[model samples]
Target: MKLWKSRSGVAAWLVASLVFVSACSGSGGGGKASGGAESPPASSAGSASQEKQSQEAAPADPLGKYDPPIEITTVRIVNDTYKYAEGDTIDNNVWTRSIQEKLGITVKNNWVVSGDAPGGQGEQKMNVSIASGDLPDFIPVNSRQLKQLVEADLLMDLTDVYEQYASPFTKEIMNQDGPNALASATFDGKLMAIPNTGSSMDGTFMIWVRSDWLQKLNLPEPKTMDDVFAISEAFTTRDPDGNGKPDTIGISLNKDLYGGYAGLEGFMNGFHAYPRQWIKDESGQLVFGSIQPEMKQALAKLQEMYKKGEIDREFGVKDQGKAAEFAAAGRVGMHFGQMWNPLWPLVDNKKNDGSAQWQSYPLVSVDDKTAQPRVNLAVGTYYAVLKKANNPEALLKIINLFVETGWGESTTPDNYAEHFTKDGVERHKYIPFQAWPARKNLDIHLHLLEAANTGDKSKLNPEEQDNERQISEYLSGKEGAELGWAYERVFGKDGSFKVVDKYVSDNLILPNEFYGAPTPTMVEKDATLQKMELEVFSKIIMGDPIDNFDKFVSDWKKLGGDAITAEVNEWHASK
Candidate 1:
């Protein structure tokens, strides 16, 4: 059964592609094959001698150049912001040249599309290729597409190739997030795709507050919900920006209400409520977290804050970019967001007002129970090989090259800068496929912090050593003053990842229970349910009667909630 249908936009394109593929496959015999003349059959004794000679001539070398060049064809996604050097095209750049030289592999693009396009055309092109049965030798696809390909029996089982060809570092990265990362791409106990594991901590939310404003108001760092409320009121009414007008907002939030940035998910987590996650109840049944009693309590608190003018009065109308204007203008003092906040609007705030000081802290708890920020496993992209391809192991070799040269101990500072950083060129883009350990960056920070404290760099890996040097230079007030901003936020004494480390050590992380494909009911009803949820929550925060929440819960159950609950439980039971 199809788990989901394309409702609109990219989904529509995917659905169309699937239908086209099915139709074309049903009407076979549309294309012809051609090849050069074949050599005459050899005697059994002669064949055995030739095989022995071949084995002796070509010893195994993962990074060694192929004796005869091999060409791999695939599509490309070009970032709009990317600028090419003088005459370099997307297909003929430093990365492609490097691959040709180091691995004797030539990459040819069948088609190229801009990744920044509005309609996900890159994915659409891929869908067309899949439908036409003209797939590239290797391709990167989402979980849903990967499922379709696997169900069609068009993809090669990479279990053996991965086992035999994957470098130790590549294997280490794949297992960084536990087997779940690989499990996402596993079918019938066989590995079909190379999962692109992402950092789990990327979704953890922390309170980014203006330390300058806190000091200006003589308030201590917030430790509880009460302190948070008090600080918000003061920042809003007490003129924390030092301007005569009461223009500062206590906190900034966008219309989405629940995202990694400028959303209320983290704030609600402080009340022990988790929305957008599947949680187990007292009955041991999987249920959606949005309609729980804890959510009502959290909404009530937000309502009170809204009435007191601590929250933006027009937040329901503001998108993330629009809401971020308050922060960029130094008119907002706090927000609950991910670790990357300091690298963005906060950095803009610093450039606009040099005195603006923002620091990241763990989320404050509403009560004595420690508040744990919610995170989700972020393995969504996967690389698959065509079943008819001659050398599926080449993909694994390319992955080894990426890891070794990018993050492994073999990386050199000079080569890294030359290929990856020179002329602001992103050579990693030329690599048709890549994957990394989810916790790679956090591990780097931990190593850098260790080296910083011990005054010994011997234990640092090559990547960490390079970062340490740059951060050290920035800390010492070296000539490249502007270069220090990113390092200071990500790896310095009070860097953002330090908070992530604290979360890890304290066992203060809540992960989603449901990590598999969407359920049948969910695929059909989730969008409608989510719309109702956002409307009801926004209304509650805008001072609608608290009773509306109970009605919402009842209505939710009546509208496919019960069926979805059963489906989710069935999945959980199977696991």
Candidate 2:
């Protein structure tokens, strides 16, 4: 066994275990085919018949079940929100049972850990597994872990397996965002891992405003940054809620300035400045975005807003949940967030005050130039196999066939309802590996819109049928409207994803220039640099000198930011 001095070192070792085992110990049980017991032939005719039966018994289909059971060992991250059917567990559910019965494979969890557990204990356990060289047949890991494993040469090359075993639908789903999605998992011209693809649009930001407040104040919908400023100022000072108190805030912000909700990243995008991202300059060299001239302008505006009491005075201490209280209580009128914002704190606002009506709009630009929502590539997780595993291709075939059988075009409504969506149980959670099409949600919305327009549900898929009914109930203002309300906000005629579709069509998204694994300097000094950035930016937002922005740029460059930049550019150039 290899000893590691640190958790990252252990993680790197664990990642490379499969390769190490394959190189040292040779291939193992994963590749062998199990055969039935043969009987001695009594005559020539019997021998010929037995030979024909043997040929027929061989597993020929890509998704064909193993004649004898095959067991794969791994660990599981049990999501806190996952719901199970009565008497079902992580090891025994419709998903797991189906895999056993249909695929002739059993998944044995070496251990199970809570996804929401504190201190990242699950990841720490994984590191221990690596240091001991006691790795399972296969596992899913993040980009950083995957990178370490690749560097250590402890993973299998999955290029041929994927090409040979992946179903056509799976291939289409993985490639929807183009080569970058797959390129993230590719190292040195070899596909090192199977990328878990998610919708890039899910990360795109938008400006969500309370429509009822807009109507109360008689303000036109925000179409420009100036309009947004005017609305925020009016909401703050004019008592749009009619409580006759100066207790309202213009826009809600959180302690973490960059995230999916209550973040300033979207707000900065309005000014054509992307903070905490890597962007390309006019000369085509990648640079850190936080120190750009555009960022200084944005910081100045935020500082002005802070001094005018338009932003939360205690925002530096408030996290997303804490700052969300203002929105939930209807004390705030506008915030910059993502598509799902309406389903969350805004939903709480509606419940608290039925009069609160929120709507999503495309981000407004500061000038004539359109504001493009900054989106990083959504390839976060990867599935890699140990080289010693007999059938590394089995993972590919399993995911491909599982998706097709359970949720693809070939899926039947009856089977889907019975095995997958029953009683709100997330049956998909039981599958050891999970992947989704990049356009799954957007496609659902398009279908929902079509169904709404035509007033017909005959052509809708099973999931869409359920959504259509929920949206109809909400629009009709029936009992149990809250459930429908959330669905409508996400999938109805004026759903938040409508803007996502428009952005996709117009190509208005600014993807991060750097999506490769973390650079050496980044892995070493990124945390410190990030902390400094947040502190300086927070102080500036809370009334520090605007010139402090320049000082921050200087400090950031001196404190490892320059090294990180060089490393990122080097990676970019090599790619």
Candidate 3:
């Protein structure tokens, strides 16, 4: 049995009934892959063009000659299901140790656990610290938890810290990524945390139809919602795979709600019935999107599909992974997901049978509507930092390190690269995944990593050589391989670059008005509202009477949904 503590200072032990916690855990330039078209014929080089490109300098060092070094102990929470390299430990890894060595920083772990839940000893340790009022210098918390901490005044205002010390590169990213992200982390006009950035890279999600199946059936790819229906009809009626058994389904829905909502409702958006997560109605009152009349129409269409045997009947229990399995097995005709879906899940499925030919299609609105598919801009899921032990500037220092190391630069200088090579540390080791240098200077590193992975530098352009250097350096060390492996996984030969390219070329990004963290009113009711949302959504999707939706909406309003909206709107108005 194991005991865990909650934030309120209660000691709870884990019994056989409890689950175990595990160790804590790029987008790019490229041409699009053809639909059902085998690999686009490779281009033949006329002659290898070798020109060393001019490189940019590192951002000016921000912490100019501070007297004595300050030590800060930051407590980090990593995902439980993280697959660590063979010898990797929570205390040491390529990512964390690089900061310690390069910047004279020391990050001490108070406790660590896996999953969003702070389970077992990790939760217990955090609770004990809170009860004792001995919290660490910095705790990078989740959005929901951040709301609680803001009410408690346990966080430091980062506005002044950011203004004084933030590197130009990071500042530029803030502007490029949009102010809504900052708005999410600010409270009372003071920035509370450094918001994480996701490439507002538009069009990451698309409709994936089985190209081989489409060819077998001689059906055209869907350009609109109606086309989607037609294809699904054919996929279900005529055995597209020519298999003897009639086991094919037109579409497989995960019923996961959030991920699919954007795609499913995207069709409704074409009809001007935009079923947004948060929307304002005719009376200018903020309302939830799930209960909207528009959602009913969307559900009705899905219900029709379900009745027609077009949608998978077992969607309720099928997770994203399982849905991918059905698609790979050729039992499902279409699925909606981000562009990276193929190499991530489908490409891997080729292990079972190499002929699983899947491709992406931009499902344009059927009504000739120009309303581009709206994708959400992510602010900060993985973006967090540890506070310095006694010195308040420690957090700022770490941010500065992330910026100066490669924030504005194309690649680290050759001298620094050499230094990294000699020390057995990667020049890009301290470079956080979201930094500007990593994002903008990608062409350089692309050439480099590709050369190393495929062992052919002649194929790389001058810019790609930079990426190759960092990739090679990263793979040389015992610790560096963790980061190296992650990079390769994202952009390698079988990486997500191809699908990501297509997505970026299409879609519209809706920059939501990022509100501050949850307020006191939400403390008592947020959980109830969340539960209500899932219950109502599940019931409606599972063929509950349409009238039940009205009842659900009424119940939701009564159960803190209205209050939460009022609080959110009040904050929104202030912003």
Query: For candidate 3, lDDT tens digit of each residue in 1-575?
Result: 00111111111111100201100001222111112111111112211010001001222233432233334565645443333345756666654565555555566766665544534454455546655766666665546556555666666666655654455556665655456667777767767777654444422345767777788888877777788888888889898767777899887676554453123544555444544356667876666666678666667777777778887787776655566567656678676654334333454444455455566665456577644444444444323332322434445555555444432233244433331222333333222323332133223334444565777776553224444454455457544233333334334453334344443445354433334555666768867776776666666667888677688778988887788788878876877
What stretches of model 1 exceed 4 Å from their correct place?
Answer: 1-61, 116-119, 456-483
Give the whole-model CA lDDT for all candidates, comma-separated. Answer: 0.71, 0.72, 0.51
Please write out the lDDT profile of model 1 over residues 5-42, one tens digit for every residue: 11223422333222111110000111111111111221
lDDT of 2: 0.72
How far does residue 544 in candidate 2 sit from its true spot (Å)? 0.4
The best candidate in terms of lDDT: 2
lDDT-sorted candidate list, best first: 2, 1, 3
* TM-scores vs. true structure, each candidate: 0.84, 0.87, 0.70
Report the alpha-carbon TM-score of model 3 versus the true structure: 0.70
Q: Is candidate 2 or candidate 3 better by lDDT?
A: 2
